[model samples]
Target: MSTKTGADAEMDAGGTETMTVREAIRSALREEMEDDEDVFVMGEDVGEFGGVFEVTAGLMDDFGEERIRDTPISEAGFVGAGVGAAATGSRPVVEVMFSDFLGVASEQIINQMAKMRYMFGGKTEMPVTVRTTEGGGMGAASQHSGTIHTWFAHFPGLKAVAPGTPAAAKGLLKSAIRSDDPVFFFEDKMIYEQEGEVPVGEDFTVPIGSAHVEREGEDVTVVATQRLVGESLSTAEALDGEVSVEVIDARSLYPLDTETIVESLEKTGRLVVADESPISYGVHAEIAARAVEEAFFSLDAPIERVGVPDTHVPFSPTLEEEVLPGEEDIQAAIRRIY
Candidate 1:
């Protein structure tokens, strides 16, 4: 595991505790539940089943059925319940088994959960965190494998974060739980097994709305989110002496760290935004737009975007592989500009 750096080192002096993304998320839940009695987790198969992805594995044994609630197979009902609970002064971490199912509960999330505080003139507290797994690497097919995080990121009065690493998974979740605003935490199902060094301290939290620079470079800047962050980093490494590629992990979706991205673009003068969402009106467009508006003068070449074309995730492994964005796609985007 890599050593601690930046804000991670400051919050965690104990140092060097490595874990998978799943473990980091579970640990964050355990710590948050223990720290605050009001905090609890509720979702389908989250109790005895330990979650479909097993991210909530063993949480039931520790927190019991009350805290680690198992809801009926109804996303809309449970999500609405979570909103009600949050409004009544409870910090509920609701998990929608798969992010694709989030559409079933879109009304509750986009309406009640998102608009409550504003509708109530900021008097009501909506400290709720919705955790859902996203991405298509598992071959979960069109319905289950869709990456629709951009919807919430664009929605008003909602905070969204998509973590790219284990530390980020843990730290960002902790911050999301504590946040007074409703935060949607998107976890890429493919990265659950990926391991990295995460902070051991309970107080550790990567601030929401912040981005982390995974690698520094000069030739080009590649801004990525979730799974693409690691893929872009690998692409950067492969180019080594050939291309100095700067990789930035955009952990927060809504509060896109344009400052960090613009700074990198000012130096590199070229950009490639890589995300799993569709290219049209997706995360890549938002990031690229921000760069153009903020750092248009620094551009040496047109910004490139790497993402899936406007299409559903194919059920066939071959077709899925063909459409999904990856290291090859990232490398190709970089090559076009260079």
Candidate 2:
């Protein structure tokens, strides 16, 4: 609940320290690695090589090669191993490098990691955490960039968390690590270097199913996820006098904080769902569906959805930027609803 709109509050931040999203995630992993003997990190280059994004840079040196295992390039092999390890009592945090590569291991994710607990008649717990990077910045092309979280969110058994700020990245990652069910933690590769205040203690964690109102206002409600959270906040700031926007960060996609959104819709009467996933049959559609279902009478305007068009992330920088929703896109969506 450390949610606020204007510049992240540094006042009275007792145990909070400033760090980048990447560093915050690494710190969470380190604390979990130290606190739990069963918690181990495994993935390509996570050991001596220190991960493609270097999120696991210094972990191998401190925890040794055994705990920070470097697996082969096979996503299915290591991912399936992590699923088996989680069911057998070990808490495995497996990195898939890029979320696009998750398709190579979809069978393990969709079939085993997601369904093990229910399929085993509630007798088993799949405490597996799959960490992957998403988004279209840095010119990574079609293969490396994608917002495929909606697929996992649509699945019944898996939990999904995507954080937009350093504090959120730390808090949500810790909670995901501790959860008994399988969790997919998606990190926007573009925001790795973005810095913010993060709680210093290992015990600090944001509740999994709660949403944070980053900016409180009386006009419209803009519910966004991942990178779009920050973008929508910026948009709100730019339109300060004309449009009073209330920004809500939908941190957890699955087990979404429907109550928070419904309440916001009641207050503002206008909602714009901003997700990086494609526009058709995606996260935006779900959020809109929720608003219509729960608070249809309170709405003063139609619900708007800001997202990429139905297509793969383009290789051209210009094309990618064009398709990806930006602050302008969010503002336009709000104006449409206004």
For each candidate, what is the lDDT? 0.91, 0.89
Candidate 1 lDDT tens digits, 120-214: 99999899999998899777799999999999999888999999999889999999999999999999999998898886778788888888888
Best prediction by lDDT: 1
Superposition error at 214 for model 1 (Å):
0.5
Provide TM-scores for the models.
Answer: 0.97, 0.96
Global lDDT of model 1: 0.91
Candidate 2, pairs of clashing residues: 4-214, 5-214
Which 10-residue window of candidate 1 scores lowest in summed lDDT? 1-10
Measured with C-alpha atoms, the lDDT of residue 207 in candidate 1 is: 84
Number of clashes in every candidate structure?
0, 2
Clashing pairs in 1: none
